[model samples]
Target: MKVLPRQRKAVLINSVLGVAVLAGAGGAYSAVTSHSDSSARADARTVTVAKGTVLATVSGSGSLSSPSDAGVNFTTGGKLTQVNVKPGDKVSRGQLLGKVDATAAKETLAQDEASLTAAQANLTKVQEGQPSTSTGSGSGSGGSSSRGSANTAPTPTPSPTVDPAQLAQAEAQLTQAQNAVDAAQRAVDGTTLRAPVAGTVASVSAKTGDTVSGTGGNSTAGGSGGGSASGSNSGSTSSGSSSALSGFVVLTNPSGMQVTANFSEADALKLKPGQAATVTLNAESGTVLNAKVLSVSSLPVSSGSGSGGGGGGGNSSGSAVQYAATLTITSPTSNLRTGLSASIQVVTGEASGALSVPTAAVSGTGANRTVTVVNDDGTTQRTPVTVGLEGDSADQILSGLSEGAKVQLASVSASGNGGFPSGAFPGGLGGGAGRTRGGGAGGAGGGFRTGGGGGGRG
Candidate 1:
């Protein structure tokens, strides 16, 4: 067979063109298939919806301290003579905590007694009548006898007694002496500082042999009266001074432990008397103390009042606003001490067996709450849900969506909706849809109730 060169060239060109066209078609098909696969993978997201419990809690910081902290100070301004109790010593009520120097006090007391006795004696003598001293010449006696003989009884003459002015002066001296004695007795009492109530000894300020003057730097004796006695004379001082001063010793009762927590205005509203609380010391880990809300102040404490400024407001520029909540520990452990830092969590409200979902599932605009429930065919439908107590991890679904309803976890993408596609598989919507089976059991809702059957699953 004889073929022309031109014809053979034409045949070769056609064959090359056919091969190129086939290659292009195959590439186009591969690209389409890859795009579909990627879209399917993007649409499906793994989510979990289940029946579980959720708790609502409020957190706050506070300090662990004894409610009754007694600040004991010395009545007199003397050198602290003796501190009988140490910081940790447990003392009984009326125990002898310490004693101030009684040297001046005893001396003063003795002088007061002597003055009182002298005053009493002087008063008695004045009342009885002054002694009469008679010094007369013999002529007066003879003349009196002749006159008496001539007539009836001679004109009776009143006995010359002590001067009334002298009597009054003696009485005044007696009163002064009595007052001195009383003042001395009081000074003696001020020397021994006793415990006013039963409790532990938190601190001791003074030691023995120290000069303790009454409250104001005045001498104990001087405190009693207006008279200023230069030397140590008990009777020289007046009576009213010592009674005005305070006791030398201070005793505190440490059994009643309390925690002061500052809550913001928002948190303060939720708190009420008798609410349960748990306290944990920052110093002691793993130790939880129980307490109850004793009181909540209607008005916030002034900025500088609390231990570290009002309720953790140290860094605040202006006056920090906070209300003081007093919490009394139901039981105090030895580890719990005054001034220890603590954190508290008060359970404002709690709901057990609540129908809850991952916080991510819920979305909406404004106050409206809604969740996207995936149907059996991989399609997602938005459903309105009534939200209840919400916690850190989950939210309580009060109504709308049931327990077993499938919900899309992540958002749908533009190319392929982020949720499961409709009818992708023969069975119901897969992926997160499977997780929505178990809804919480049903029971009376609201108001902390224990042991109620959980809400039912869808």
Candidate 2:
């Protein structure tokens, strides 16, 4: 029982060392628990419902063209004597675009006039019953007696009789001559090329002294869709050049500018005439035009380049089906041209000052939509909701949710486990926690859009 001072000191040192070891272990355990909790919370994102504007739109890429585009050319083949217009020049209907040499046309017309005059005289003489004047020898026996009896009576001269067949033949010849003269006059007039409509000259294929083959018969009145708006006429030529132009001249009416775009079959179903649209030009990135849906093609245009799937007969060739839609630019610009690349956004549905939530927070279809509501006590409850105007980033909440209600984004599973991991979640799909810009569920700022487009700030 007799303990030494050194022995007590050693015992006390051992006790302190053991206590220190336990304290260190406890601290490490606490740190690990805290990290695990934080990681779990990071996978969950919460947002508040608010009143905002939500828009549903269908988008597609296309090109600008004018419905009032036309191609002009000479009707009669000859050397071009004049070219009065160039690309970008404003012209009116009947404005002289160019002229071919009319010398040969005039000469032909003169010859026709001479033939017509001779035919007319011959017809008049025939109608008047004019007879040929000829000398005749008298018969010997009776003639001598008659000649001696000249004092008795003068032989009565008979009036010439018109031949019915001769008159008909002469009249027909006159008619033929008249027709020739009229045709000659038309040929002379055809030497001049004129604008078929009021428009800006888009291209010129010929110039003074250029020999044109007279493509007048194929000239168009510059109607929409039928013109060179497809850039088929974008090729050009200069004055006196020997190369073939799309036509003698190409013209387009800027006032009649429109855009043609292709949309997926799903998006196409939502498109209708008179739907408002926004058009952005690829050439001028900053420029946007106000437009409306002019028409949506009822038939689908099949393409072999699409990823094989869906209603377009996408078989093994990777083909896709798309429908063509036309939009008329209400706010047109003077510089609009055919073949300008454009992006179109047509507003199919819109809701203003409506209660809304992020698209990611809502799940299920139509009447079965549901959201997870986060209570003040940190518990979540499944709440059914009515959705209207489903947009890209946000959806309009019609009922079962109110402004300022906190809601948790629904969890999407991958690998059959309840967890958020890479490669399992596609951005903009249900419940991978990330903040989106533009009409986001958080009601940050910008107009909310939905429908057949990807999600981001826009």
Candidate 3:
């Protein structure tokens, strides 16, 4: 283990060189880190709030449903005894669709008939004169009576043929009995479910032994099982959600097709009958059907339940009241199927060819509306603004701010990350890129912007 002088000398040199390399790496790391942080801070996004046309719209999504009137429902509830029609069966008005257990109805009818007959006989006897007569019979309890009671015929106190009180009472009883008979007969007939109008049977959930509740109608509503909330929120897509069919049998007029959706109460207020709208189906995504707001229900769909909605939102948790809306599809075809998810946008208000700016640029509420304006220097000033209309993408500038004014969309700090600004998540790092210098940019920054709808300010 004796070391040579030259070899020892070489080891010392190599060790020194390794230490120098470590020192150099440490310096380089600091420089690189500093440069990266500076780069991130230098990138600030400045945007101009311009003027443009904006539409304030109310959007709602749900299954392409049917009008409540389109459903054929049973007016009376009963046990389903027979189902004559299955799904897809076509029938006409007054056609028997199914039958219920009518044994009870029949018994009720029989009793009513007997009562009616007795009432009529009593009435007849009252209308006719009755003579008073007296008769005596002899009887002995312990011993034979000394003399038998004598039979006597009293002179008839002429009975008035017209006894107004007796006549009225008898008449009322007869009428009541007749009503019972009619009601009982109707109930018996109701046991047999029939089609009130002609259409195709879309479904039949009731079997022979199934007990079905009456919808207080004579027929069943036609559609898929989604007529009830069972269909609610099902088949929901980016477009909307739907509800279930509570009807046992659904009848659909294939030629008459429409989409029924529920919207928040706020949106409902903006909607009115005959308003213009557009409907998009989840199935035929490419098909943007032209439609109109047939009606917006004034009543709340559910109790204590309504979703906050404006443009492009429809989900609601528990007890959220929604107003039902009917959209008549002007060009619905065979391609449109029941229970298909759909989204609709009703033009509650519109302002065309007006001045507008990025909605993000405008902040504050009501009369205190303002936007942050970027000065020529690397500084921003909050500028008072008179906003006319606010849209999903932009807001209409009524006054205060002028066109081409560079509004500070957002200020970014580079100390964190210069690389992968769109961080690991959907939102990325800092508020993702704002409206670039270019106009009409959105669907960015955590996916906030939606349709061209704007809240009308003026």
Candidate 4:
């Protein structure tokens, strides 16, 4: 085995070179295998692009309230003798709601009547030709003084007469008495409180023995005295007076039920009077109350301000602005009651039998939509698409893809990049040409070829 040093060195170098080459080839093979495994895992995700319908809805919470709520109060101050209706009692328009103790009112009325009668009698007596006793002393001193002459010659002027002043005073007193009588009569009328409208009794503030009074405890009756009455003015003011009549028996017509929705100013602009709405109460599920927008207040409704986002976000707890939108119930249910929580869904727009795909299947920057479609050969292709009306679950695709094409949902990831596989062609490759066998057009045993038109790539 004797060998030259140069020959041995050459053989060693060759062996070293061979080892390095083998290492490089092995590394390349491992990398390729790892990449292929990752791609297989990505392809396992099932995505479906289907033909379906979608609906967009605006949801807002509100409370049930009555459009017309009336409070019944006593016009005159007295003990409540009788409460004809209790809370929850149905009543009719002009039905007797309650009665107050009229003993004091009646007695005052009697006194006023007596005074008026006396005044009228005095007036009659004055009108009639009645003789009155007068005292006048005419002495013969006049003659005696005239005869005595010299020292005392004086004459007395007759006192000026003004008899109309006494008559005027009497007329004024008569007018005052007549006014008192009229006022007393009105107070008597106020003793009986009647329902102003047909409705159910929402609340009863006054019991049978409770004392009711007018504003400032003033008389409810007015007279020719030209003084304004208290309760006879406005009912709202009448009920706001004192504790005796502070709270009132509320009467509400159930049919007049309305939903008070607090909407943001932006959403309010989309709503209009006479728009249809569906109301769902908290207690009732699967039941909808039909309603219409009765009115939208020009003024904004003040509410607690808060952030708009649902979950934890930047200052979501902060204040929010809202406005009141009143909706009248077109069809009311018996179970609906005041103070119940409700949700309203207002349909802004609707499409019947429109084509749509899962919202997840469509992806893009705002207003520019794209989707990743799965090719028949187990590869992904991103296709640029023109989208139409968006909905809860799906979107309308205007163009760029045909029905029954498989689309991939944006691969959800914790990072939110949509986890699309790298190097994968979108829409089955560019220029309307798909991956093919033998890597040539019209090649024998080649895979499906794309159309001649150019398109986007995945």
RMSD each, Å: 16.9, 13.1, 12.7, 16.0
Model 2: ten consecutive residues of lowest lDDT: 443-452
TM-scores of all predicted structures = 0.52, 0.63, 0.52, 0.56
lDDT agreement with native, every candidate: 0.58, 0.69, 0.61, 0.60
- Best-to-worst ranking by lDDT: 2, 3, 4, 1
Clashes of 2: 6
After TM-score superposition, the amount by which residue 218's alpha carbon in candidate 2 deviates from its true location, in angstroms, is: 3.9
lDDT winner among the candidates?
2
Candidate closer to the true structure by TM-score (higher is better), 2 or 3: 2
Q: What is candidate 2's lDDT per residue for 1-458, written digit by digit as tens?
A: 97669989899999999999888866755554455445555567799999989988878888877656666566677898888999879998778887889999999999999999999999889888965564444445544554555455434555667999999999999999999998788778878877766787867866788787754333333312212211211212221111212467776666667888999777888999999999999889899999999999999876656432111111234345789998889994687766788999999898999999988798777699999899999888989999888876789998999889999874423112223222122121222223332212221111122111222222
For model 4, residues 240-307, the per-residue Cα lDDT tens digits are: 11122223466665556778887766567667787778998888877789888888878877757553
Candidate 2: regions farther than 4 A off? 1-43, 86-89, 110-182, 199-202, 220-245, 308-317, 411-416, 420-458
Which of 1 and 2 is ahead in lDDT? 2
- Number of backbone collisions per candidate, in order? 40, 6, 47, 13
Residue 64, candidate 2: alpha-carbon lDDT: 78
lDDT, candidate 3, 430-457, per-residue tens: 2333322111222222222322122222
Q: After superposition, how far is residue 202 of candidate 2 from its true place, in Å?
A: 4.4
